[model samples]
Target: MSSNAHSFYYGGKFLSKVTDLVRSEIEPIIAARGDEFVDIEYVKEKSQNYLRIYVDKDQPGGIDIDEIAALSEEVSEKLDSLEPDPLPDPYVLELSSPGVERPIKNAKDWEKANGEYIHVGLYQKIDGKKMFEGTLKSYNDEEIELEIKIKTRRKTLTIPRKLIANARFAIEF
Candidate 1:
């Protein structure tokens, strides 16, 4: 099969085909171990292609290196046995926990993060601030409410969801 057939590209953007394949193959293995798949990325950086998979424990404490190593080995073995490889070129396979500060990519992420400290980056500045960090009070389809601190006082900021470019869990000092 042609390399193009294994890839999904349109309008000068490449979507995650190999990543999806890898995710599909490893999801069951991860779930059986009481872990959840957070995200996957297949990208070329500095002449090297990488397939990075992020996994998190379903329980509270989070996953560790040993779990990541074991999962990596299982995923590697499965990929090696595929008769027709999904990825045409060589790539490094990475598996690990999403860490303390994990990117919030979707509504599920936001929902899981309610009442947790988070940082949000906006595409356009709101109230002269492009970035905001606070406890995620609530979120909905239209907006999110964050309880921010201002000079020893607290204030709630309501930001439109459309204005946010990125969001992630945060560790406040």
Candidate 2:
């Protein structure tokens, strides 16, 4: 079979094993490449398993397909060689750039993103609302200062950083 066909067939059955492989090795590779490993998950659907990897750097365009492909190839080789089960069925391998909408995954990520606009949602209503989009001005030990603009008005709202249920860099277009 062609290399493409073989790879396509093999990319459907390794998740936990591959995750373990990447969670241990791929982070270092990403770090060395000046990027951060945001997340790794096994996407299982019926008879196929998809390995999903998310990596980010301080700004947009920090990650690319080459990085993902290199990581995927390395991880695949490592798993193919080290697995106790060796050839445990097949699986699909995917490496992707975690675009602008990627979630802020760690403190370092947040710190690097300071001064950028972000979209954040709260678990419960705060000051009668549960969502806020603003410039991430500053962050202290407890809360984050957001420069929010509502219509023709502007205000700096202090929100506990921990209270952010989810946050992501907003697209500036």
TM-score for each predicted model, relative to the true structure = 0.83, 0.72
What's the lDDT for residue 134 in model 2?
Answer: 88
What tens-digit string does per-residue lDDT give for candidate 1 at 47-161?
Answer: 9878888899867788888989998998899888765677768999888888889989877789889999999999999889999999999999999999999989999999999
Off by over 4 Å in 2: 1-21, 32-34, 45-48, 57-60, 82-91
What lDDT, from 0 to 1, does candidate 2 have?
A: 0.70
* Residue 149, model 2, lDDT: 88
Model 1 TM-score is 0.83
Give the TM-score comparing model 2 with the true structure, all chains together.
0.72
lDDT of 2 by residue, 10-89 (tens): 23444434455446656776688777778766656787866677776655568667777777777677666753533356
Clash tally for model 2: 8
Per-candidate count of clashing residue pairs (backbone under 3 Å)? 0, 8
lDDT of each: 0.84, 0.70
